[model samples]
Target: MATSLPSHPIGVFDSGVGGLTVVRALMDRLPFENIVYFGDTARVPYGVKSTSTIEHFTLQIVDFLQRQNVKMLIIACNTMAAVAAEKVREISPLPVLDVIESGALCAVAESKTGGIGVIGTPTTINSNAYARAIHQMDPDCRVYSQACPLFVPLVEEGWLDHPVTRLTAQEYLKPVFVEQIDTLVLGCTHYPLLKPMLSTMTGNLKLVDSAIAIADQTAELLQQQGLANTQRGMPDYRYFVTDVPLNFRNVGERFLGRNLGAIEQVSLDRL
Candidate 1:
């Protein structure tokens, strides 16, 4: 795979629309690198699934992405990262990056008080991936985690700052506040969409946008691997989904902060 040219597209996948947050970050950070994104909408919300099931789904998606000849793989989904990241790394020939690793580094760097909170899907929080990652770099840092299952559905619904969203944020964050955490990790890509509401409610806790960390780290890795794209001008982007919901285009556009090109639907059966 190292023999592959830098011009090859980077492959990124998520359970559904939330992973677009990472896609948006990658576009902003590496404008010259083409991207191929896959969303497993048919199996959306890997949060509630067993670890084995999530790993199986992740392997399937990674296999499909590999068929596209992507130069790199970014496991942009938090739940998948929590459960299947190691298996992906062990099996894939491409360099693999995941949100938890970058997010942990950021949390450690941003936490002045040594008290950090992480919020994501129930599966992610239960897996303790973020906590383990943070502890690896800063053993003394206190880690607290919560699962904000409602946030994904709310973001998908485009009710970013709706009264209900705000109310839910308050409930989800109350325990973290009691811990007096000075830093917070938006464990799920979807949670970043609620930054305004999260910020207004969380007081001064520094929020670590894992998307930014992952983007920066990806750029660094690409440069180190000699895989950074040298192409000038615009880079092409292609999107795929396992199942296309009725409002997929609009929701995706909102998450991506731009117009979406052709979005094709795909299924695991083809693999």
Candidate 2:
């Protein structure tokens, strides 16, 4: 039998621009695949919402991506990944990948002392998703979780290295530091942008970003399924947001570490 070619773009969605981190990793790891990214900026900060609301929003985004004929879907937000991943998998026709479990697995694999610290949005920490996943992998592993609610806004405001970010990181990570964890997972995609401040505060703890792990897993899954895009030409990437900000292009360029072309705005209600 002749093999079929994979042509549909991979779809990635997040509550805001944070998921661009995952996109950047995907570009480096799977350069031949086209990408379609969606940001729920109009409903930004899914962290503060209830689980049902997050699930509803996630379903909507997944449906929109399905309409776009994406080959796979990536839930790039930790909170959504924690609360709605299975729900999405149940409903989505394409393979669905999430950030939390991938990060938890990486932290568990890297931890020598079985002490892992996770810092994420309020919803993600409160959900105990990382702790549950890590503990399930290794019952003896100790998981410490903290809610750094301000980190998302700080990252959105482009205050990555600001003194305020340092102070905030110190305050948020105090409990985790006291736990003496050997591995720290950046549970929120936005948290990676604040890595310098987090590292300075955590002091010697190994930091793990889910983006790389998710990218690696995505690559493996594609290969196994025989859905890997083998094109040698330059891949195309499209970005769409519920609400386009004035600095969307500039901020996105910094986050993705590359120039983003046109960004289209879409109405969530219509979708």
User: Top model by lDDT, which number?
Assistant: 1
**lDDT by residue for model 1 (1-271), tens:** 3456799999999998888999999999999999999998888879899988999999999999998989999999999999999999999989999999999998998889899999999999999999998989989999999988898889888899999999888898888889979999999999889998788887788999999899999999999999999889789999999886556678888989998889988866964
For model 1, the superposed segments whose C-alpha errors exceed 4 Å read: none
Q: Relative to the true structure, how large is the alpha-carbon lDDT of every model?
A: 0.91, 0.88
Model 2 stretches astray by more than 4 angstroms: 1-5
RMSD of each: 1.3, 2.3
Task: Residues 1-271, candidate 2: write the lDDT tens digits.
Answer: 1223477789999988889999999999999999999988889879999999999999998888887778888999998999999999888667888998789888988999998988888899899999999999999999988898898889988899999988888888777888868999999998788887777776788999999999999999899988898787888899988986656677778789888888989887767
- Residue 70, model 2: Cα distance from true site in angstroms: 0.7
- Report how far off residue 71 is in candidate 2 (Å): 0.8
The clash count of every prediction, one per candidate, is 0, 0
